[model samples]
Target chain A: MDRTIRVLVGKPGLDGHDRGAKVIARSFRDAGMEVIYSGLHRTPEELARMAVEEDVDVVACSILSGAHNTLLPRVVECLKKEKGTEELDVLVLAGGIIPAEDVEFLKANGVDEVFGPGTNTQDIVEYTKTNLKR
Target chain B: MFSGYPGGMVLYLHNQIIQGLCERKRAGLARAVTLVENGSEHARHILEEAYRLRGHSKVIGITGSPGVGKSTLVDSLIGAIRERGDSVGVIAVDPSSPFTGGAILGDRVRVRSRTTDNEVFFRSLASRGYLGGLSRHTGDIITLFDAFGFDYVLVETVGTGQSEVDIMRYAHSVLVVMAPGLGDDIQAIKAGILEIGDVFCVNKADHPDADRAVAVLEAMLGLNRQWQWKPPVVKTVASQGKGVVELLGKIDEHLEFLKQNGLLEERVSRSYIAALEDNIRRDTVDRILTEARLDGTLDLVLTQLSQGKTYPAAVAKQLIGKYLCAEESDNQ
Candidate 1:
């Protein structure tokens, strides 16, 4: 079977501004991937549950509320618990107003890459295409 | 139990998945739905098992135009169903881009209120080139959900226009939601949609013209002439949860009407017919086309047609004769 790339673009904080997430979701869609946008104000648990239920290949979250250090890693931890098995590999990505200093901290946790505000959409697309774990 | 290398592995996985599904594990149900959505070879086995175990859940289809609050209404309905101590599964469909075959499934955003509730399972699907406002495998997925032992299954179609009435073939009750001030009063008079609605809801009832929209829909419903079960039009502001209970009550009444009148069986049989026809098309037309493309016959036909050498109907007849009839005769 020809598998289509499935990505979950989620906002895990109280950030009501979802413009960045919407843009990335659309970019993924235009690149021929199926994107599940988890609206807004999603907790880490909810996002993790959605990723597991949707069986997506990637979990690309956008957070602008400056809670990346606290929330992004929780998303990864919750996803691991939700899957309950390591057979399904998921690529975790973060994008938003994340700072350069915090990128290493996020990667140390579980995030594979971080795209800043001005990062090109195509670059993110390529990054996802190349870094997909499945 | 084909003990061959990969076939054995596949069989093992399938058996494990089916066991989990029978035991009401959400992970198993989720994986089974993915297999069906992806049209995997093992999907046939899963669906066969699902058919044997289904028929407990009520399948409801909610459809409307863009920005009609279908998703919000569905969220409210999920809460209502759960309050009554019943489990529900939701399938929300969005359209895919025709050029790129990509889709952004945002319905989950509006319907994520019940994400923490294990009894409420939600899945999003892209239409994936199916133009009738639904995914191709919607029926199969619904079967999987039903077999997982949910009390209710809600299938929300992509924002629809006139003539996306395929929902009627699969759903026992169809809820047609409309908002006020979208010039939908004229839309209520259209023939295709007016005939398929089992219950009509005028959402965004907080708007000033909400009552007027309700009036228009009722007037249209009155023109049906015969009245075995007249579809009731209820006003709701789905975002605020206003009038949602009444709407759900009306939907339940429709289901009750179907059961009492022996019409539920008819609807089930209609779904069967639709599923049969869909499989036939996939097995015949889609298979032939795929084989033709692989063997370069499609390219040859296109070249011939461009040169005015053959017509479309003649080409179709010839391909069917070559691929379908010849195989039957050879088997004989």
Candidate 2:
């Protein structure tokens, strides 16, 4: 079955800055990916639930609220708990105002990649296209 | 704590999808819908496997022209349905831009109050070139939604187009929405549109002339004396959530009427026949057309017709005889 890449762009925690998430969502839309933007102030549980329901190839969880350490891992854990082998192998990635020092910690907790500020949407789109497990 | 099977692994996307559907997983339902909407092969498998799991849900079709408050009415209706303690699944179809094929499916956003509720499932489908204002995949998605165990599945059509009325073929109850201050063209088109409504709603009832619009609808219904069930006219200020409960009550009365008259099964059979006939066309005529194009038979026919040497009826007979009858003979 032919499938387009599906991604869930989520903002977990109280970060009201949805500009970056919305921008990435538009980029993904332009790139022909089916993107479900799980708008602002989403908790880890909500993000996980939406990610599974969307069966997204990637969950690009964006956090600008500095709660990445507490929330991102929870999103990853919730995803790991609810999804089955029959669903898309969701890849979790983080973006938006994530401090440089926190990148490795997030990666250690199962975030596939981290996009600090200045990373172009094209780069993420390229990464997504190449990395999607068809 | 790690309950979600890690997302990465070679999952038979088809098996993975239907399994989630069987388990009633929201993610599975959502993904399978997209697969079907895009005409993916997995869609067929999912729908086929999931068919037996359907039929328990009632389908309600909501339709009207753009800005007629269909979405708002649906939002209110979902609340009303939930108040009666049943789960609801909504399918809202929006028009894709003719130029870009992009649509802002913000209907789900308008119904945002129900988004976080576990009892409500919302899906938006872009018409994606379907002239009828309902997606071609609408039927298949309804089947999946039914299988997922929603007690009531609501389908909202792509605004007001004559073809949008085609969607009524799949619903147990169809609400034709109209609002006050519509242009004369809409009134004229009502002759064609009025035939399909199980119930009529004049939404945005706060507007001036709301009663006049309702009177006009009542007058139109009066012109047709043959309706076994006279469609009820419900007035609703959808934005303010007025009269939504009364509309739901009307729906109950209609459903009860259908049940008492044994027409409930008839509506279900009507939808089944529609789905069956669609498949028959897809499997037979569509495939044959494709083959004819590929094998030059269509071009030959076109050339023949252009020269006035032959016509479509004769050519169709020849092709059918060549392919269908020959296949039958070969099997014998």
Candidate 3:
């Protein structure tokens, strides 16, 4: 098997609903991967540090408070600030109730994919694998 | 000189207890979790041992709007799991007092009567303005519980904001709670929430217009046809324990479906990577704030932006300095 992939999952800002994030985290655990969940209300700076310290391969963020347009990019910016874009080896993904148009915008800004409402667990798993494999 | 043999024996005994915890020994699990929460030296040793067994349990988070009765649903499921002879662990993420930073944890308080049950290991965490409806040490705590051998671990959060969504990133499955008469606007207002839920619960189904609300949600789901698992709609009167059994079944089915498709491994890998990055970012910030003392510069920048002397983006550009990616890419 390849090295155990690590991830830093966080809820940034004031949004408190974590049911979705927790479920995803558990799913990952059941799949036999290492996951470090930053318990709620994290700043982007804190999240970036978490990614680096944990040596995570990806940073999957779930934002439902509708701050993705602002917060998502800020998270990407924080990660990239240390070095060139190459320093950002971690795949930054977002989930939660994002509008269709906004998803495209976020992807343009740096989000790998924005899984919206009703995206199946299997699809997410497949997408994640395909992306990570690359 | 100290007796090395006795010390070694004591350490051996500690390891045995920790190993027992990882094997799901009830008393051992309790003791180990307490040790970690208390930040005891013994806890550190226990954690170090448990860390080797870390990536096993699936952490499912349940969150929704307040008064949607999320706790009651969790309670019902706990009871259901017990009926099936499975031990269940729960971490209730309660609201923190914005003023005092203490947590109310009303959910745990309501379930106090069940705390004495040998099969149940429950903890209440204070959000403490942690923003994501979880404790800063939540990851460690979850690992502690998992190592302790709880078959199913559930986290219930105060259903609002990015904090609740953050919990999903940590969990294997997410259940979004909603109720009728909350109005169409709430549904629309929280459209982002609708997108994240793997399972949607229209709680308080006994209330008026419940079916209509379900209809509306069904329509919404229909519009979005690109999901991995068709987000199922489960209606319940959580306060009364109605539909609890069906809901539990659905949860199990979802779990099985994920396992069957080999999606479980992929999801876990993504979550692991995400978690690693989050940990790195958090540590880096702590180091900067504590060691570099960048507060002064941050304050200066904020002041400058507020005074209209510079745009926020421009300030960010200056604060980060000239090693912009385009400029630095050539050197690397």
Candidate 4:
């Protein structure tokens, strides 16, 4: 019964830079959450599918490869498609070098929260802990 | 408003949970698994509802020492199974960090190919301090997957040293994975692992030491004349997806061998008995511990044991005599 909040730390698409994703994954673990690290180069559909299968409260990914505009929203869209928009109760967040101007765009397109560079890992963890409804 | 009627509310929740399970809903299965893993108050009702819906999926256990490519082999096997038009459910168990009580389940990441495939359902589990090498609820969760109607329910454990053989009671057949250059390490575990394997797979077969590993396994098997079905040692390079199809075929052959000899029924019986025993222990011991805590007897017993006035066995006896016997009679 030591189950705390479960989170999926994903690396979506041709992003070989998993350093940020891994760092957040470790941070989440340190924050006492069970993390499932979906390793490098996963498609958006795969991440969404993993989110549903894992029954995780949060699905957070890093997009340092500059594909956040398409990849982040697509992950949300895919989860909606697979689990139904109304039934999918997951918080989709993105981080890792997202530009300041486009942060609002990502959130508007179903990204629950967006964390860019120079953000604190603890802040991200706290955001997930507070925001996740599951 | 319904909180005023407690029994009615529980009944309502029970029906809702059971209905979700019968509809073959993934969310339903996931929820039931969570309930069972946490040993929630609703867990028994869910299992009772699910137990009758089993017997369709073949629970196959894939186990080996760590770093032996078990995940890659499972991924390859998933592809081979799906090629023939069957769905698979995977349960990958990893170790819980002793310090943090959290785990980074990296095994599921390797099987990324099957993630979006509608036919493959993947779940990651932490061992939860169950030294038996799998989650304590692994059997119950397997029941949920089986009830959900997958053709193959594949369970990948945290690998074995010796005590990890509990998987045999849950899985219909076990695939013991090995690789090249493990030296005499396999020899060291011979007594514990030799009896549990139905199929021995030597992964990394492209390596030069592959043949030697296979020979060692086969020679070990040769020394055992008691096996009705002599386990076959198959070679595979799991990363390249080589020999995986053949490996699946070998597993199927073992499945047939088990069925023809009526061992499959025995396996199922053993699985249920194991599940029942675990549930009984949880219900009995957990209730005793909870009642002791509530009644302040737990501290009293600890004080007596620490003072060395009573041995450990006698202390356990006293607690059971006080709380357990009375509770049993009250239930009757």
Leading candidate by TM-score:
1
Q: Best candidate, lDDT-wise?
A: 1
Reference-based lDDT, each prediction: 0.89, 0.79, 0.68, 0.85
Candidates 1 and 3 compared by TM-score, better number? 1
Docking verdict class for candidate 2 = incorrect
Question: By DockQ thresholds, what CAPRI class is model 4?
Answer: medium
- Fraction of native Cα contacts reproduced by each candidate: 0.78, 0.16, 0.00, 0.67
How accurate is chain B of model 2, given as a TM-score from 0 to 1? 0.87
| Descending-DockQ candidate ranking | 1, 4, 2, 3
lDDT of 2 by residue, B1-332 (tens): 11333334323677778787888878789888988877775577678766878988888888888889888888899999999899999898877656545444546435645555788887777676667668767888899999999999999998875545777678988888889888543563455566788889999999888988988888878877898999999999998889999998887788888889999999888888877776665566765787789999889889999999998899988887766665643321
Q: Write the per-residue lDDT of candidate 4 for residues B116-166, one digit (tens) a residue.
A: 787889999888778777888999999889988899999999966755888
lDDT of 1: 0.89
RMSD of each: 2.3, 5.6, 22.2, 3.0
- Full ranking by TM-score: 1, 4, 2, 3
Clash pairs for candidate 2: A53-B27, A80-B4, A81-B3, A81-B4, A82-B4, A86-B16, A89-B7, A90-B7, B65-B160
**lDDT by residue (tens digit), candidate 3, B189-229:** 34456777778888989988899888888888888768779
The TM-score, computed over Cα atoms with residue i paired to residue i, of candidate 3 is: 0.60
